[model samples]
Target: MVSITISAAKRTSLAKDLPATLNFPDKTVDTLTVSDVKSAFAAKYPQFYPSRQKISLKGDNKLLADEATLASVGLTDGAELAVKDLGAQISWTTVFVIEYIGPLVVHPLMYHFPSVFYRTTVEHSLLQKYVYAMVMLHFLKREYESLFVHRYSHGTMPFAYVFRNSFHYHVLGGVALAYAAYSPTYANTSSYIVGTIRDDPKFLMGGALVWLWAEVSNLKTHVTLRDLRPAGTKTRAIPYGYGFNKITCPNYFFEIVGWLVVCVMTGSYAAWFFLITGTYMMALWAMKKHRNYKKEFGKAYPKRNIMIPFIW
Candidate 1:
């Protein structure tokens, strides 16, 4: 048997490793000694046991008594013992998303298309175009500053930020479409549609109204659902929870509707393209968040689908 000291917080974790076997002196039983553990670790992994620190012989998620306690319990020095490790594993979905979906597929396709399409002036008022440009700039800045650029404890990349950033485009596109309709820029235009070549003021108005309504709902609902610790103000917690939790990602849901409205108002194929893209991305994020909540809260999490009502 071995005498080992265990760390306070890690006791619960190391207890899980007790069932695994460890190295011991030759001619001894399958079990390890306290000295044998120290010696084996020092020789094999110099960095792990640089100095004598507390160690434990865990078995089946329980901490075994030290040598004295084991001796009292009638366990021999060579008796076999098991140990296990209780570290969380990486999810395969996270790997697939960061490696292929976020970087190679969704990001490049959805983000780059707008840059190419809006590269030139297409008869929309210069002022309106500039406003759209500002919105895009803000969207990019928020993603890079608040989400993408942050570091995390785990060895994972920033796909969540990318998904959130994409949602911004859906809403902003509708806003720009609608705002341009009444603005001095495109009011007197002879033709707005590309192929049909006609003035369509209703398209702009419809897109604008939807975008405005969606934004208001998103901001309000998000603020209502955020989680706050005692240190956090209720106001702060509500908004924060709305942004992070799966229970209330209303912003993403409304964003799709915003784009749909933009398409109906402006009659632009580009608008529909954005709607489809936003829907695909939001659905993935929502599902991932929902699974995480279920794992975290078990039966306590509020019953709700990603975006839709009970039907979804």
Candidate 2:
């Protein structure tokens, strides 16, 4: 037999006078599992329900999986196991809905419907209307994908940070787009769209194709990634097809393409700013994801560029 220690937070309902060590068979039993160990505790103490129980080797922050053996997680004769409550858990879908809907719903109102009673005297132009449509379309696509095309396993950011991210996307982005892209003067131009062709046929025809194709590619990449994993498991596979062959994060690549197309069409500082900053952040994230993929998959995964194709 072996003895193990169980620890919990003080002042809780856990029996304070319980002995520090509990006996267990020295030989590995075929039926003995981490879930069984936790179940024994829950049978004795109602507060330690198996679902609510989070056990880990002392000094390690990661929770041990239920299917894992006690010894596999480093439990031994004199080992200490820390038990704590996970408290409450929220689904990623719920969090994503709040994050995407704020910007998608609230930001468009400023561009589409403005009151004469408001303090800002912003007049609309054809370019302004076009920019408004594009911005609305971008955010609507994000909302749709978040709701349908993405599946998260088991990870969470703090609720406070989720609120902050929503504000950053909608409130900050809305003010910038409304102030710059919706200017009244951009539409009063007669510049040649192509090298010699006038009447803005270049952007109307060429840019529309590029922008929409990029958006669709981005959506396809997201759906491909979602199908790689089942509902609530932390398993992933190498992405195949569509955008995965050239770069590690083709979704970010296509998103950058969409923003650059907007800059070409509108020639607005806001569009350029979005393109540059978004590129910088996405590059950082792509590199991070690339490194993480390498670390996780090791020799089994293929080498790929971070965000760009061969140039990167």
**What would the TM-scores of all predictions be?**
0.42, 0.75
lDDT per residue as tens, model 2, 1-312: 555677773334554644355556743533346666677667777665676667777767677877787667656556677777654444566677776676566556665555522444555544455556777788888878877888875554444556666655655455665555644434334232223322355455677788889999999999999999987776789898999988899999999898887787777676687678778888988988898899989998787888988977
The C-alpha lDDT values of all candidates are 0.43, 0.69
Scanning candidate 1 in windows of ten residues, the lowest lDDT window is 229-238
Spell out the clash pairs found in candidate 2.
none
Model 1's C-alpha root-mean-square deviation from the true structure amounts to: 12.1
Best by lDDT: 2
Off by over 4 Å in 2: 1-55, 62-67, 77-79, 83-89, 116-123, 185-201
Per-model clash counts, in order, read 17, 0
| Candidate 2 C-alpha error for residue 141, in Å | 1.9
